[model samples]
Target: MQKPLLVTDFLDRARRYYGDHEAVVATTGERFTYDEFGERADGFAAALAERGIEKGDRVGVLDPNTHYHLEAAYGAMQLGAVHTPLNYRLTPDDFEYILSDAGVDAVFADYEYAEKIEAVRDDVPTEVFVTNDADAVEGDWESFDEAIETDAGFERPEMAEDDVITINYTSGTTGDPKGVCRTHRTETLHAYLVALHLDISDDDVYLWTLPMFHVNGWGHIYAVTGMGAKHVCTRGIDAGGIFEAVAAEDVSYLCGAPTVLNLLVDYYGDHGDVPTTGDNDVRVATAGSAPPEAVIRAVEDDFGWYLSHVYGATETGPLITTSDARRFFDDGSSARFGVKKRQGIGFLGTEVRVVDEDGNDVPQDDATLGEIVVRGNQVMDRYWNKPEETEIAFSDRIEGYYHTGDLATVDSDGMIAIRDRKKDIIISGGENISTIELEDTLYEHDAVADAAVIPAPSDEWGETPKAFIVPASGDPEAPGTTEEEIVDFTREHLASYKVVRRVEFVESLPTTATGKVQKYELRQEEWDDEDRMVGEG
Candidate 1:
């Protein structure tokens, strides 16, 4: 009765009960049922073992959102190996750093990205190189197609629930990306939490719009698979492709960041309209940032999809809180958008709180700012190979809680809304101006879209809010709204003290692959010449 929880059990459950169920709709036009997918994973594991890859070996997977990446994850973890997924957005140098840092014993890369891996193969001590396209592969690499056909004769290795199973790298905002080590227990609990909150079921047809490399697609790969839902993979995010997949596959649920949703909204508005006749009852789970209330409204009224806003980071096992106020919103209240905008209280098996510097709970008035702290089974235990950071990440003003490094406030209803990242909070003169607040206001303007705010070096005010906006048209050639017009629009909504002083109408904001705008990059450029970068609070 006391079986150790392992991620491979998700596939095992599917294979045993739902073997005939269609599991993966690969981008390469390949379809596999649960039985077939499991065989492929077994073969992949067998091939790795054949190459002398043992349990506890770190297997790196460098590819986009595809069935290959998914299969590679299960294959590595099936043999009790740690699967390290590399971000494709990062350069070859980043790859070199991550592959070397994770001590990757084997790597399975996509055909298109084989060169990036080949460039860093010499630097990294990886023994096995497996690629989808064997023609492009150099350095005695194994072909993925040929390897999966070989029946792996090895039995499933023993695994503990607390065993480190996956090593996910952080966004690397300040310096090198740190690996967040997640255990089998943490990942299993996270999958269950996500599935429970999202109400993911066997009937749902999940779309792979989000990158598979990012926190294992925010743990959907496990949750969806365990539920026996169909996975329709899209190699890249394009509005047309998304609609086509939804129509063709009858997609029921998908997840993405606010940026991805914004792109879909703009694409629909500019190019054509979303397919109205299709069976498109879409439910999108958005994180990465607090999306504007207007964006939430557009998703529901304009795009005809239900949107749920969740919040967490790589350290917190990713799904900490959610705003699943469906029953409350169903009454046709005007405040639904406002309610949907807030990142609601802790998910099941998680505890979240907004606390001040002394770790005491902040007043529930919703204006008082503090760090969002969490304690849950979903939170990761340590950062891989970084004991100091591991100690610091769990250094709670409150004992036994993990400090989220995100500035937030708790409303009267216990909804936890994120105001800004700790480093991203702009201190103008002596006032704390949340960049998120300004950006949310910018989203209210019909013409302005995909906005980010940062602190600018101000001669008198120490620092002031500046805006980088992407037009709603999503066309670089089209001229965006004027700075004065934007400033005037903000003055109507926000107080003068919190109002943005300058506006830079850029074609797009620099964003992480996960759809989070890299505000630090813009902030550094803005304060490059200034003696002091951040303002004194």
Candidate 2:
């Protein structure tokens, strides 16, 4: 009854009980059983151990929603090595910073993103480079297919529940990226919570619409695998492909951000007669931002799939609250969409509170805005190599609670709705875009004097970055730079998703009495017509 909780146990249990069952449906039109998957993982672990990798070493994985990512992750975890996943959407510089900061020893990159890692290979500490397709990459990388063919075996080191097993780097706000260190206990509990709330089972078929790098696919990597569920992999998100896959593979469950829902809704509107589901009933979970009531209605009514809205941050297991409280609303009534729009009660064993600046819980009046804070076993233990930042994150406005920096209001029924973001970051299409990084990039331009970035409403993406610029010529009518030029400049420097979509030139920016730029003024003006202060809802 007191056995230590470890992430490796998930795969081990699945291998023992579900070895004969189908474990994965690869994007390459191939299927594998649990026994084959386990054998490949063990071979990969053997290869790493032969290459001098040991326990506590960082092993990086850079891939899309593919079976290779799952294999690489479990293989790293099997040898008690830290599994570090990198976002595929990030640029070469972002990868450089993350790989260097994490001190990754060995890395497995997909062929499509291998060139980015190759661009900064010398700068990072990574030694053993592996890719899915060595023929497609430019670097001298080992092939994943050959690497997993080794017949040798590796000895798994004994690990405790408190040992760090993973390091997920956060999207930096105003500074360098911070690695959120998670232990075996936190991951195991979070997986249990996800499986309970999402209702995953052995017969369920899971679609990898969500990226595996996103907080370990919102902890579904463990939850689904531990339950012996079938995984259907996809390389990228496409509305037509998702529909086709669901109908073909009989997908029962999936998760995505609100932007993915919008894409599906738009596709369904155009192709009215397209098949939405197969023989099995489908249930979807959406998060990252609140969806519009109309979108939620379209997903439930037109698509005929149940939608659950959840909320959390990368540091909080990315799933602390869910809006699936069936007791509060009748599914037959139109009022159910309103309840689903709020980030409902906290998950079991998780304490979610909206507190004021003085570390006191705010009244459940549904009008007073307060920062959302969370305390749970699934929360991160600390930030890697950054003691000061770690202390500030948990100690800000309260002790032992991770400050979410999201301002929200709690209703009388304990349902919380986000009103605004206290931080200067934009969540565009579920990707975090730092305004400071964009501003710094813009300042590098000769025609720009001062710039302020904020989130703007978008029907497609929940939010997009909008920049307000002060021209060096001190003239709003005839700024030295063009909006297209500013947007193009950001595209050249930052990642594709972080590019500025809207730009307005001004004579001078609105500043406070102390000469600090007032970004709230820009945000208020931009979101004046919206019902909520933040994006989407």
Backbone clashes for every candidate come to 0, 0
Per-residue C-alpha lDDT of model 1 across residues 1-537, encoded as one tens digit per residue = 787778988998889989998999999798999999998998898888888888899999988889998899999989999989888888899999998888999999998888888887889888899999898766677899998777657767888999999999998876689999999999999999998999999888999998888988899879999988888887778887887888888899988898888777777777775682257588888987867766777778877787888889988989899888665567256677777778887898788999999989999999999999999999997999999888877775777788889988888888888888988888887888899888888888977867889999887888889988887666645646677888999999999999989887777888788988888789889989877668654
Candidate 1, run of 10 with poorest lDDT: 325-334
lDDT of each: 0.86, 0.88
Tens digits of per-residue lDDT, candidate 2, 1-537, equal: 799999999999999999999999999999989998888889899999989899999999999989999999999999999999898877899999999999999999999999999999999999999999999999789999999888788999999999999999875543466899999999999999999999999999999998898889989889999999999999988999999999999999998776578669878877879898999899999886566676788888888899999999889998999999999899878889878988889999999999999989999998887899999999998999999988988989999899998888899999998765676568888876767567767767878766788999998888999999988677978887799999999999988998999999987776421123567778778989999766751
Candidate 1 has an lDDT of: 0.86
Best by TM-score: 1
Q: What is the clash count of model 1? A: 0
lDDT for predicted candidate 2 compared with the true structure? 0.88
What TM-score number comes out for model 1?
0.96
Off by over 4 Å in 2: 173-175, 424-537
Deviation of model 1 at 398, angstroms: 2.1
Give the runs in model 1 whose Cα sits over 4 Å from its true position: 137-139, 473-478
Output the lDDT of residue 429, model 1. 79
